[model samples]
Target: MADTEHSSKNVTEVSTDQQSNQSSKVEFSEEEEMLITMVYNLVGERWSLIAGRIPGRTAEEIEKYWNSRHSTSE
Candidate 1:
């Protein structure tokens, strides 16, 4: 039972690490950067409106992309 629990914990840790690495791989291009900046400028704090203006982009998607780019650079 102890061995099973340890193995499960190890597996979970490895999976989490893999997910973190995958997330770190995400990034934005220069065009994406400009778009995000433009959106913020146009809408201020209204992220939904800004996201709507960009075809197929959601607020969460933009945030995730930016975060991933930052993480990779760091």
Candidate 2:
């Protein structure tokens, strides 16, 4: 009975770990996709001008943010 309980607990723990990993993977993939779209939309065009038009954004900061976002994505 003790061994059975231990086995069951181990299985539960493994299942939980797998579920957590899967959730994190899905979130990361989604973020990566969104960032890719954002970068594509903002690259080498009027992004700096747009950012400048925004109330409190600098073009350098926007570029840096996009670069950092893209780096993390890879």
- Largest lDDT belongs to which candidate? 1
Q: What is the TM-score of each candidate against the true structure?
A: 0.60, 0.39
Poorest 10 consecutive residues by lDDT, candidate 1: 65-74
Please list all clashing residue pairs in model 2, or write none if there are none: none
Lowest-sum lDDT 10-residue window in model 2: 24-33
> Which residue pairs does candidate 1 place in steric collision?
none
Q: What are the per-residue Cα lDDT tens digits for candidate 2 across 1-74?
A: 99999999999999999997664432224554465456557665455664644445555555555565567642
* lDDT for 4 (candidate 2): 100
Encode model 1's per-residue lDDT on 14-71: one tens digit a residue. 9999998886565666787798878777766566776786777777767666554455
Query: Could you tell me the TM-score of candidate 2?
Result: 0.39
Q: Model-by-model lDDT, in order?
A: 0.73, 0.58
Query: Cα lDDT for residue 3, model 1?
Result: 100
Clashes of each: 0, 0
